[model samples]
Every structure is written in structure tokens, then in C-alpha cells.
Target: MTCPPPTATLRPGQLRDPFRLLMDVTARHDGLVRLGRGPLGVYIVSHPDYIRRILVTHSGNYIKGPLMKPFRTALGNGLVTSEGELWKRQRRLMQPAFHVRQLQLMESVIVAAVDRAVDRWAAAAETGRPVDFLDDCIELNVEIVLGALFSTSIDPARAQRLRELTSEVFAGLASKVWTFFLPSWFPLPGVIRYRRAVAALDAEVHALIAERRAAESTPEDLLGLLLDTVDAETGAHMSDQQLRDEIFTLFMSGYETTATGLTWAAYELARHPEIAAKLAAELDGATARPRPTFAELRSLEYGKRVIDEVLRLHPPFPIWFRSTVAADDLGPYHLPANAKIVLNPHMTHRDPAYWSDPETFDPDRFTVGRFGTEQRHAYYPFGKGSRMCIGERMSQTITQVALSAFTGTFEFSVAPGFEVVPQYVVTCQPKGGLPLILRRR
Candidate 1:
């Protein structure tokens, strides 16, 4: 019986900055390393083949790991954190709603939402004031997703409240990741706050569900789709609680990740004028109209690449987790049953072996015929396999529309002395927000 590589015990300070520590370990150990010991053991797998095996090839042999256990209170057994038969059922029922044809129906909502944001930025640009691009992107994404999903818009006060509450919930959840062994009922301040925030969020979701339920005519949206979908085997529909969990999961997963990706893209574009210019030119050449149609969006090849490059550099969910259900062989390492496995897309994305000059930001690396075939698994921002993000098409469309609108109308540069650092909460966000000065294009 071959043993796994020796565990590399993390220093106390290293635990506080898991991203950096994990990256260091990946670099030193050639993309596969063990950390911790015995019951608390974790294997960090960064190689593409290992990631493919764990996520796709032998996925049934694993389950969502302890890292996601902390999120269950807030996210419940929705697609983001659920496993087993329940996940399979939910995935089947929800799959159609995110299909490409269904997503096309929401394109107008996306365009309108982005137009509203562009109008807001136009005023800011006219006043020569800097805007927090990250905040604006988050707001735009939340509104677009809400409109697309429910055919409803959140008022400013409600939107602000929801934003604050969700932020608190995410912060609280992130605080518990490393200390996942602790019981949620332990009455810790962070845990208590997380529960409260979840409750508040639940109230909002329940209100939406009630509103939809009471409607005389069901709208053509994701909410309606969920309310109407029936389990063929069980002949039952999602209960209110189940509806709340799914909606809440979609609410967070749908908006936050895309918002972060767009925010990073905007930040990069602002910092790199040449790339921004090329992207804007591509958009301009694609269509003379204010908004690109679904066909036109596909035609904006460079714009798509820009978004891909941004996701590669700053994946919203930086690390994905899984746990082995039985002892497995991961290359030379013996992965024991029930051991935690961490796949760091962030580290693998920047590995010198896979990406040349990986630290530099170059959109051209993703250009057609330039992006090599060797890095297929190396570039999965939405993850890979059947469990890949269901909202992948919707997210890309939202970002593409938002980017076209923003770049077509304005040019933004990062404000002086504004340091941008990736803060890993529930997602990788730009710390202190992305403050940028805008000029009308």
C-alpha cells in the first residue's frame, strides 16, 4: 500500500490567508500536496488531470466536502451545496430554465438593466466623479438577475438592505470555512449573525415566492418555471422551503459571481487602455446599434475572450472542494476515504507550467488560434463536468451585454492610490472596491 505524500502542516498565520498559503504549497509540491493530518486531512489537487478525475471521471466516488458544510445553513441543499439524489432531482428540474433558448428570452431584461446602469454612470462621468465600479457592477447584476428570474425590480431601499444583509451573510460564512468543525448552534457571534442574515434573506425570498404564488397569471421567468415544475417520478412540486432554498441559491450564485467577474474585467480594462481600446473597437465593429443581439454577442469574439481572461485571473469562487467517499488513487498519492480535496483554480490558472508569464494580464493570450489546446481543463472558470455552473450561459450573456454597454459609452481608469487586492469572502472580490474615474467615449 503506497502512502500519500507527507502532510505539510500549515503555520498559524498561514491559516488566516488560505489562498496565499495554498498557492505556495501548489508551487512547492508540483500541484499536489497534503495538508493537516488524520481526520482533518486535506489534499490540494491543482493538476488538470487530477481535477478532471475528481470532478468528472470519478465524481460519484466523492461528495461535496466539509467546506460546503458551513454554507448549508445559508444555502441549504440547493444546487451550489447539495449532493446525492436530492441534487440530481433539483438539477433535472432546474436545467431547462437555464437552457440557451430560455436564456435568450431574458436578453432584453439584461440589456435594459445594463442600460439603466449606463445611464447612472453617464451622470457620474458628466460630474467628473469617480464611481465604485464593483458596487455598480454588483447592483447591475443583482437587478438583471432579479428581473430575469422574477420579472420584478427591487427598489433602492430594498436593494440596499438586501446587499448589506447578503454581504454580512457571506462574511459570516467565510469566517466559518476553516473552523467548519464547530457546531452552528454553538452561539458564536459570527454564526449567530449568519443565521440572522439568512433569516432576513429568507423573509425576502418568501415574500417573492408568496407574490408569485398569488399572481393570477404566471410570468414567463425562472420563478414561474420552478413553481410549475413537477417531479415526474414523485408527481410533486417544490415546497415553499425548497423554493426558497433554490431561489436563494440562484440569487447568490447567479449575481455575485458574475458581478465579481465583470468587476475584475472592468478593473483590468481600466488599467490596460490598449486592451480596452481593442475590446471597444471589437464591440463597435460588431454592431452600430446600442445593444448587441444574441447573434451579435456571439460575434464579439474578442469581447468574449476578454471575459474569459478575466475569469482565468480572478475566478469568483477561487477554490472548489470535494471529499472522497472511498479510498482512491490520485496519481502516486493514496487518497484515503473521506479525505478533503481542494482544487484551486486560482493557483492552477497562474501556474508557470500551464500559463506563460502567468502573473501578467494579457487578453491576447485567449485570442483564437493563440489559446493553445493543452489548457482545456486549465481554464474552467465556471468549473467542468455535469456539475458545472448551470447559469454559465446567462452569466456570459450578462457580462457581455454589460461590457458592451459600458465600453461603448464610457472609458474608465482606476483612481490614483486605489490599491486593488483580491479579498476571498464567499467569492474573490476586489478589496476596498474598484474605484474608477470615467470619461465618456
Candidate 2:
């Protein structure tokens, strides 16, 4: 309980692939390690024990911290960046919209969006054209999220513009992370563009809110539900700015995560035909039609396992950051207040101690009665504890339904000598996008 945890020095340019380097360092150092030196050095914690400590047991002593300060600038005081009382209130108000019953009501919106995208994929399949699977998934998720929020209010052009603006904003924010040492007064193009993107997005979202406010009646959708939400204590309805912030938070959190998961799923399915056949068989036996209702889709046992394995292997949000509020010890090693802690679920998910044959594409790993308590605690594709993803149910539904529609109606293939590398950015995704050849089943 006395010696310090091993520290690994990061060479120049290694930040480009930090997750990979982190995995190597942490695995070699017994599930924990420090990178670099001084105040800027980061502590990488892959051990479930320390992760549960920071996120759950002693969650009160850890905050999203300075690591998430940039998001506050980009997204304002939304749930993702807000802390303490503000976060608690926002979570309470938002919880009901993602409830099981609410998500059930939104199934039609999810299915309809997937169907339209599949129709386009079908046309490409008939012509033997290779489709960018990631792009298709990204576009589909945008529709699903927007349709759930606005009912049928947002048209294609508006959706595309929103997508472009968000993409720009995220790109700008990520670029700024590497230049944190620079002065705020520095003339950085990314920061300037990020500011412009946020402004344009705010104008667009505010206009949408004003239209709903002036309407004779609001439609039954996420925006309408949120518009009517009143604080139990304050009795105050959400202001225009609050609604815009929540909308921005929901979109930023939802689309890319679901899209990245589906993209990895397709890549794995194409690479493993036997597993794909088993999944298709289960799909065929369980689902009586091309499209499954919410109930029918949940009954696909093997399909669910495939989804589980996909998430374990390719978690969308691979790593998250938190900082200590005061001095604390993780088992033996001690960390001072404001210590930058990087929790990498990507490493823990594949630890051989918790998983068998860690690198294999085996959905059966998630089959019934296979996991011990340690393995269960060690797996966290949706994160752990109080601040776990708010839209877990909605994200899973979108993912499962999209997988059903795509696999149920088509066959996926790749070039003979193709390879895909993982791109670790804001979200973990397949590098160079996934280009797959599709054919109708």
C-alpha cells in the first residue's frame, strides 16, 4: 500500500492514438498507470475497482471537472457539462421522456427513420454500389433523433444544416484540446469556427422553439414533452435557452454514439459469416416480418447478444474523464485533488481476466449464465453509476431496430482484401468509414 503506481512517459505525437497507448501502458502496469509528468500528466484507470470508486462509491468526491470545461462553452450548462444541483434537476426532468413507456411510444419514429434509410440502401444494393455504412447510419440516427424531438416539423434541408453545424462544432472543440496551453486571445481558426457553429445552431434551435410556442397546439414529441416540463420545486417551465441547451445536449449525445455502434456491428458481421448466419437465423425465427415491432425485436435473443458483444468490443464512448475533489487513495496509490483521471472502458472490456479469448468476435460470450460477478462489474459499455448515459434505453432501441432492419432485408460484404482500423476521437469509430457492398436477401 505504499509504492506509487508506475508512470509511463508519452512521446510526442502519441496523443493521436492515446487509447491504444493507454491500453498498452495500463495492461503492462496492472490495470493502472500514469502518463507524462507534472500537472498535465493523466492517470489512466482501467481497473473496475478504481472506476467504480470514482463513478459510484465516492462519486460525490469526483466531478466532471476542468476536463469537461470546453463542453460547457460549446453546449452551455446542459446535463453533460453541468454539475451538482443543476445536473440533478435536469436529470430528474429528463428521466421520464426516456422511460420504457415513452420509448415504446417512439418506436414508430425509430422504425420509420430506419426504413427510409434502408430504402436508399436497397436501391444501392440493386445497383451493386458500395455504400458508406457509417454515413448511412449517421444520417439515419439524425432523422430518428430529430423526428422524436419535432415529430414531422424538421425537413431534410434543416436536418442537414444542423448536422453540418454540429460536426463543425465537435471538430473545432477537439482541435482546441491539443492547444490548451495556448492563450485564449490566440487567433485559433478552430476556436473561431467553433464559436460561429454554436451561434448558428442556437439561432436554428431557437427559431424551432419559437414556432412551437406560437403554435395553436404542440405535437406529441420530445420537444413538446420538454416544453411542458415544470420543476417540481420551482414550478418554473423551461426557458427558451434551457430548451435549446437540452436539445443540443440530447443530439450531441445521441446520434454519433448510436451511429458508431451500428457501424462497428456491420463491420464485424461482414467479417464473421458463421456468426452472422446464426444471427440471421435467430432473426428469421423470431421476427415474422421484415420490420419488427418493439416487442418482437426484444424477443430476438441472439440478436441482443450480438448487440451486447458489439458494444463490449467497440464502445462508442471509449474513455471518460473525472477529477478528484480532495485527496484520496485508490487501493494503495494516492491522488491529490484535481488529479485528471481517464477511465478507459475500452481496456477493461477486453481484459482477459474478465473475458475469454479477449480479441475474438464471439457473441456467445454474452449468452445466458456465462458471467460471474466480477465479469459483470468489469463490463460497462454504457458506463456505470449515477451519471451513466441518460438515453440508454433509447440508444439501445435505435441500435437493435436498425440492426434488425438492415440484416433482415439485406446481405453485407466487403472487398476481398479490406481492412478497418479503429479511429479514436470524440467517439470510437471504424477508421476511413465503413464501405460495404450490400445486396438484397
Candidate 2 achieves a global lDDT of: 0.84
Name model 2 segments beyond 4 Å from true. 177-189
Clashes in predicted model 1? 0
Clashes of 2: 0
User: Model 2 Cα displacement at 129 (Å)?
Assistant: 1.4
Best by TM-score: 2
Q: Rate the local accuracy (lDDT) of all candidates.
A: 0.82, 0.84
Candidate 1 structure quality by residue, lDDT tens digits, 270-295: 88999899988887898898768888
| Error in Å for residue 383 of model 1 | 1.3
